[model samples]
Target: MAFTQIEDYGVIGNLETCPLIGNDGSIDWCCFPHIESSSVFAGILDDDGGGHFAIQPSGEFESAQEYVTRTNVLRTTFETDSGTMTLTDFMPVVDGVELGHTTSAIYRKVTCTEGTIELDATFEPRFDYDRVGTTVEQTSEGVIARGNGEQLYLWSPADFESSEGEEEHAEATETLRADETMWFVLQYNDREPIDAADCAALLRETIDYWQDWTHQCLDASGCPFEGPYHDDVIRSGLVLRLLMNPQTHAIAAAPTTSLPEEVGGVRNWDYRYAWIRDVSYTIQALNELGHEREARNGFDWCLTMCHKDDPGEIGHPLYGLHYPPEMVEEELDHFSGYRHSKPVRIGNAAGDQQQLDTYGELITAIYTATDYGEEIFAGEWEVIEEVIDHVSGVWTNKDKGIWEVRSEPKHVVHSKALCWAALDRGIKIAEDNDFDAPIDRWKGERDTIRETVLEEGFDEELGCFTQTFEGETVDAAALRLGSVGLLPFDDDRMQSTIDAVMDHLMTDEGLVMRYEGDDGLPGEEGAFVLCSYWLVECLALSGRVEEAHDVFESATEHLSPIGLFAEEIDPETGEHRGNFPQAFSHIGLINAVLYLNQAEPGETLDPIGRGATEITTDSKS
Candidate 1:
């Protein structure tokens, strides 16, 4: 029903790439070799048509799944009328011989849990989403599925059937009479085969690998928690770190493909790309947990994507796997979208938009990186100087806001405040780094932005900062005005702004939306998960720790039973929407928990949480 809602899926990846595993035990969406490839198994889009790779008990089975401790090793167990079986999914993490953090490969294994149970495994490989077709060969080891230009080999147990174009009957039959075991191996052509006997041994190796790396945050996890939802906040941070591109150092939105924003709503766009606006919360989350690698990757992407060299040059509102300026947007007209949300696009059209707040986010990233003991890029600093100079010149002009609504542009308050913050942080950077910038010019522009916002951005009658200048509509984004420090939380404007957003933007579920009136689309969407966390953060910053914890706990109620968060949640049915296991949602949770902890010290927070906040705040002082 409703295409199972986007957020119902759990993510498994080898840093080089990721594949989403839905609750149904199917590999619903998977891109080979990288996060941005044609789907090999995409049951997430069409349960019947879209191909899938799954292994569970054939008969009726009650299911439970969890990641094994610190590693990405996933253990999903199914209890049926016959017996119980567990599927261990993971990406292989190899350390360089010299030591430190470096990944090599990933491996997924399936095993027998407590009771030996027969399993039904199915391998339906649909190359290129719709099916350009793969050359399937019955290898001595298993079925080697090969697609044109895609060398990913899918090896399953022998006896798997096939078809000419769309392979459907490729099933792994298990009779419950004895213990049955099966493994699916998807590997690039250039590597040697991994020696994995059963899924449990591989699961053990993967767990050790992740524990070794995540052990670095063992202390950070012990921080006092703010609410009942502490574990969720921490793991979200870990997910963000893993999603970042190690090569380009950019963080993609979700390591997924074609998981539509609206089910059958024709609003499906590829979220496997990065946006600085999204990374603002991401940076804060990583820094709080002391996760340096992901924090630095976020900063790297922000610097490259910010158009800091020419901030006024129609800044790229978003980016794909890399930060190339000319990366064009195109729609995949062939494949039907997840839940039939058509116009499945790979690149982002928001790249050329003028979201004024993005530069401010860039500033926040750099400043936070600096504060977290990270090295600032020499080239990026030069570009940032120019970008800050540009913001100083045109802080009042507005083209598009953060939501990137397709409608006409307006003077959005969030955009203006970020502009002010960009200049303010730039001034701080220039002073700290002893760089010669147009200081006098920047200060004047910053002053103007502050005054203009106080006068025009505030609604006197509503006693709060409106979404747009003097607009009555309160926005969930307004919660960031204080979070970004354009105004202090004690200010009446900031407090009222939070109140107005909560009063207007919130639904009965306690989640929020971007705005009330319009978002340029026709159908109603789910509650914005990030916006709700912003409310939690706002509550904490406003010295309402208990309230913030309460809100945070309420938000966690929407998580799928397996501890995964999505982009949005249904207002009525409480189902999740947008992409599954979205890093933005998790990062928001991490940052909010940090604010709650700062507000009050009560629950002992595990410093080694997956979503470590100290890492996001690391910078080069």
Candidate 2:
């Protein structure tokens, strides 16, 4: 079996975990029960060793995949020589229900639309990342695969036969005429059989749930959901929502992990966990769409994570969905990585690294939420004060920057600017709500940080801000200094930084790389998707709407056929790299659209950063 290209997949989920269904009618990657769990199907990582669940035509056929308009439910159509058939896939989800109570089942409904077609189905289970042995037994309903102390129940009407010399595999073949339908449900732990009526009702409910959620984006007050990029904006918004756990309000960076940033390279990392910086940006984007409830829920979750027993202690850069005790990175050496990128990792080691910029990202998100009328409670205020105080004392310290570089710590300019933003926003929150705080000291520290960055973090010769203090290398992160309100978009230094980044770090495709210099990692990565969107936001706010639009189009031109983005994109071939359906990339697209919607041609717009006096509330008619 050959590995499917990363871009040839669409995702379907129940707000907890998702399965990546390939265009060729295969679920190549899936994590059972939760996004971070060991994979039940990991064919994308190792084609031969990893197990997979596939349903495709018996003979050669042409296939295409798409979403069920505005919903995460996916449909793949196969056109065979004799007939055309459609396979609709979705995970059952109940609106307003907690994750613990929702059904953890995947439903695939196959219908022949024209003539006759023969479908072959394969069910292979590899529990515990294929480390433990799995045994499958025939049952009245279908078959049960048990391994690693867990059981998977497949409820199907078609008769399945055990594969030759393979007890862990089941195969089935069926021929259907026009209008004939078949249903297959893969459930976790449960053994209750479901009829066609139950499957039909679940499908309807799932579709309605997603459509209603998408409607909220349209009905949102002050949302600019309508425009030339309306479809793209809505699609991005839905992708972000799919990564969010509806019950805990915890959002994953992406569903699958270890999808290499560079194919056949060693730049792969797991993105199943939620990052503080990524969630903060997601809140801002959702807030811009007038989804204040989701924004507030996410903010509340972040604050909960920030509560610490030790005074002035800050949380890790990222956390699991339920705030696990530890996320120790582990490699499954048995399975070859996607496209032979070795060392398929499950957990993340970067969670232990110190990323100081998280304080500013958190506080900026709090300030943005409050500006939109989300109340800040006394306890959350206490946590905010603790975070601000910590930043005040350590703003000058060197640590791992936003890129999470593994090299020696340096005075990264982006980190310093964000520290300034934290202080600035803290002072504003205290002043606005009349909350008691050390206003004078915060102001002093904030000013010192700003002056220090402007002086030491800039290169006079290059006329632009450098990646590090007195460093010569330019970084795409510099584009965010203006968006964070550390500098005005029209400031000469910021303009120079943007120009320098474009001249140095941008690809010929107009997509921006995170940085040009080394980051203590082997193998090169593709253009960072979020960085390119940052360039778009910076240009739009600087009154260069046309130029911004051009970059925005270029940045989004390589979206998956179903309108999803990965963590990075190959500038040369336009292929997706890194984790699929990255939340940060979608957030960047949504925010860029929001910024562009408010920008007046040739007129500088107010910075939509921590210092912004008002939130943009231009309603969509």
Candidate 3:
């Protein structure tokens, strides 16, 4: 029913929750209270039953949207025959001080900048995914929406009237001249009513808070290629931060669920839950960009969830919002899928699979944070050792692998390489800190893994590293071997794999496919953006600097106009597919840009526009 293009949206959040604001000026998707909570405004799914909040020009108009410079606050402008107006949307965020604000709120301000303009707004809420009953009432403060034992207060500075009989909907229209401003606040639950007088100040404080935080990000001074890709790097960091749950420190893969990898396909699954592997990658990226606070938070989350009595058993790959894993995959039959991609799933079944690569990811994140000057307590080190021991115990087993294919497990090459990484980092941390551990055992196991993988994962005839042990299908994951420190850039095997990947897995658009073989899923998905970045890294490392730059430019040319990217891209149409504003995609962009910035001895292209020579191995060895 709701047919909104996934790309036609920008996001604003308070680190606790986020709302997807569409180009047409509608809050189409949001989860109230918590990122994983039930949706209050899900018009992105069901147009009629699902709720929405909209502020727009009354007549036919053209609109544009963008996030404010260096901040997550979204500004949407509408131009109509009458005039033009801009709408600013953000959630109040205050740091370094307590503001006695426990309730969540969305603040919206509208300002006219041209001739007289007529603007209309609506407050429509469908609770519990439109399954629960709700009652709306007009009050002196503003309007009240009550449902599921919770209340939402709507306050406005201007004089507006609520509908009498149909209390569920609130509509208002006003004519405004240039420079005129109107304010509205929608506060969740009942605590203290927000005063209309403070609306302007609240918006200002929120803006300042975001700007201040963005400025703190490690930028041009210390970072090599900060100038050319400054905006992309900063925004990517912000998006990653937005995906982080502040209270629990868990980072979501993506906010929305069931946005298919292919239109009308069944690859839809919820990514709101935090995966250990994803969080590790996110932390590594954040730490590299001088956002150490988020990295520390991610490490602490892993400790709390994966340490102590249970310690998550090493092989478990994900954690729910709270403590235990809640990744029971189920379809939400109530709402139509995005673009009719049916069987919309709420939970990810991949959480239970034996993705052995997570141990490597977790250890790498912890070690990376240490490089950022974060201290690991003795208790945390013990947990790290436990994970390494587990990896050593099961390094030779079959796994569902990083792609989380829904078929019989196999000895994925990437999984084995990551197991080597886990042992490698564990040994490094132990040796560097002089902590107690079986160093010799870890060293032996690490070497054993390297030898096995080098022998079995590579195919001399194919001249590339295969997806699985002794297999011939080229996988994009092989491109990561050099980046992850498992192989040298100039190593013959690594170079051959790089050339083979470009030859087999690349689309004409320069995007890279995840693998050549099917993994038991129906329908075709687009080229993975992360895999494309991996190819760029491989190319840069292999002394193919100019080729890498061409590939990098080609891949980035397909980014959404505002620089956002999805999980996958339709190689044919160049359209974004899957969950939008994807964390991994942004991570890939930041890393590739950083790699190109430090690329060595290559043609000196414009510093901001081209490649860097200093390749960071992430201490994978």
How well does candidate 3 match the true structure, expressed as C-alpha RMSD? 4.1
Highest-lDDT candidate: 2
| Global lDDT of each candidate | 0.69, 0.84, 0.78
Quickly count the clashes in candidate 2: 0
* Residue range 1-621, candidate 2, lDDT tens digits: 788888889999887788998998888888888888888899989898798899999999999988898888899999999999999999987766544567889999999999999999999988888988888777888878988988899989888987635436999999999999999999997877699999999999999988877735455354565678778888888888778877667889999989999988888889998887887787777776666677888888767756766423343578787656357988889889999998898888888877778888888878877776778777778877888888899988887889988898889899998888888889999888888899999999988997898779888787788889846888888887888877777677888888998899889999999997788988899999999999998899999889899999999888898898999999899999999989999899998888889888787776553563232221110
- TM-score for each candidate, following the candidate numbering: 0.89, 0.96, 0.92
The residue-by-residue lDDT of candidate 1 on 176-207, one tens digit each, is 43355556666654334544464446566666
How do these models rank on TM-score, best leading?
A: 2, 3, 1
Error of 3 at 59 (Å): 1.4
Off by over 4 Å in 3: 97-103, 157-168, 215-222, 305-308, 602-621
Alpha-carbon error at 598 in model 1, in Å? 1.6
Ten residues in sequence with the least summed lDDT for candidate 1 = 612-621
- List the pairs of residues colliding in candidate 3: 596-611, 596-612, 597-612, 598-612, 598-613, 598-614, 599-612, 599-613, 600-613
